[model samples]
Target: KESLDVIKVLTSKVRWITLLQRLTLKQLWVARNVSRVSIAIWKEKSQAVHQYCARWIYNSSIAFNAIDNDDFRLFCEALGQFGPGWQPPSQYQLREPLLNEEKKRTKEKLKHLEEEWETDGCSVMTDACTDMKRRSIMNLCVNSRGGTCFLGSKDSSKDSHTGEYIFEYIDKCIEEAGPLKVVQVVTDNATNNVAAAKLLKMKRPNIFWSGCAAHTVDLMLEGISKLPGIAKLIDQAKCLTIFIYAHHKTLDLMRSHTQKRDIVRPGATRFATCFLTLHSLYEKKALLKNMFGSDDWHECVHSKSVKGKASYETVMNIGFWSSMTLVLKIFSPLVKVLRLADGEKIPSLGFIYGEILVAKNSIKEATYQMERNYEPIIKIIDEKMKGRLDAP
Candidate 1:
């Protein structure tokens, strides 16, 4: 030991590392072996911990990002302090063998659905979208009592989407799925799609042709949006949202006034969004009026701006609020119908037609049994419904 201390002073690294030959050298070699054995044990234990944690996460079906949560991190830290350190599955395991196992299980579960498709029949629903590649892609799915299964997608970038083209494509899909297994085909209410439905009616008479209920209701809202009064109301409402949100300070003030609830309510469709925003404005009428009339608003630079002055008058406009209430009376129930048709939960098919009727009654009642107020709105609704949703 004394020799090693003297050697330490002689070394450039300022520490004595080498074991002098004989008695001390054997002790050094035994210490190295113990260190190596401890590391090996820890590595094996860590791998086992990772495997266990990965299986638990998979079985529990928690979100993948749950591990990033503050609560979950604290929970993990507590375990590491008192229980055991855990590891997750490797990327390879998640992507390869585990993925294959999930696929096999999904297919096995889908077999019973295939049997139901043959017996109860399914709806062949199609929707089109533009993918990131700038190609128009059409997706096909089969919806039955069991569940909805995605059949596949096709890039139709080169194909024309004419009535005849759509009919032929849908007919082929039906044929491939077994024509008897398809009870109906549902698509958007585009002119080409309507034409395609007619062609399908002529050829496959047993298979019903149903317009996409949600799209149909959206078109109804689309028509109502073009009405002179509703159009002006929406324009003003949009301007109001734009003015408040464009300035962060004003937005913060507005949030303080409204208890953090935003005045903008976006719906599933743009047309729906207009009505929803109007509904939001109506609901926050008191808050907005209070905001515009506040001392803070008077002190702010925006309060004196042309836009701000206009916004104040707009908020205080009695006729504007009246029109908004009237519009919502007629359209709010329809928005509910649109949501019902758009949602997947609770099998909305049976409820939609009944709800549409309910919405009509609601509009009528909203007008206080006076035909004059509701008549024009009903006329627009009837026009959109006539040959499409209303037709036998």
Candidate 2:
């Protein structure tokens, strides 16, 4: 190692500035030539290659929200480190010239998709979201046997998202995507969105408007969570969560009992979080029983407080555990359907309607003869699905 270090020092002492400069220039020349030749080859290979590459970067930017000018430069610079033959596209090269090029390619592709869909038909799914600046944006995406593609987006903050306004937005998407090509439109179960769907159907009777299956199941969960019996249990569960998590010592004791798992897991939706919170509590039932009986719990001063005592007693109550079971029995199916609907691997259209039926039947069989218990839950799901046109 010492001899190698000495050899390295001796080699470092040599003046290779001119050689290094020549190598750098050669690399630059090679990179420029490769980039130019690559473009020429891309042109010869057909526009599909260009479109495929552009869609990859564009979709990645939208999916991860990480493609900025600086990020692009860093990505290209990192790639440049490998070899001069592998030149990277500049941000401007992508954002401006390549962007326009891709747009043209996309239009051509959209035209082709529209032509193909003329016979088979496609579905457009519309959703509204607010960006970081609190600006409402309307986005439209289309799916068919051919493939799925984003149609367009518009800033809708200024406009009232009335049925007519949304209908117009849908119309514009249809016009761009080819009106005759779209056979169905799907949106959330919001009243205005429902109205918009109805209006679009009136205009384009041949096209169906279906309510989003994911949103429908979420609403079902929301309704079920609000039932008086379930609501009380949820409140107790939340109180227990707050009491334990609010105090570090109690939280640590909880971790010790449950092998460091919180009694509440974060969820993407409100009802989802509510059910998951209850589910977590149910999972930690034994740990919680042990916790209330533990020496540390008895010694803790907060344990004597009204909130803490109430929470501890709730955990000890058999009725609370029973109520949790009922909650899970009624709502777990909705969670299942939610997962099935939100899945990406397979198309959901084939299974969602059938799953809704199975979910209803499972709950019915679980709570049979307890008509009072199951009636409201079944009613909510039925009413949500009624006339919503979810069938493929």
Task: For candidate 1, give the lDDT.
Answer: 0.86
Displacement of residue 298 (Cα, Å) in model 2 is 2.2
lDDT of 2 by residue, 294-358 (tens): 99899988888998889888989999999789788888888888887777764456578888888
**Candidate 1 lDDT by residue in tens digits, 144-219:** 9988888888889999999998898899889978898999898889999989999999999999887878888898
Best by lDDT: 1
Candidate 1 has its poorest 10 consecutive residues by lDDT at: 12-21
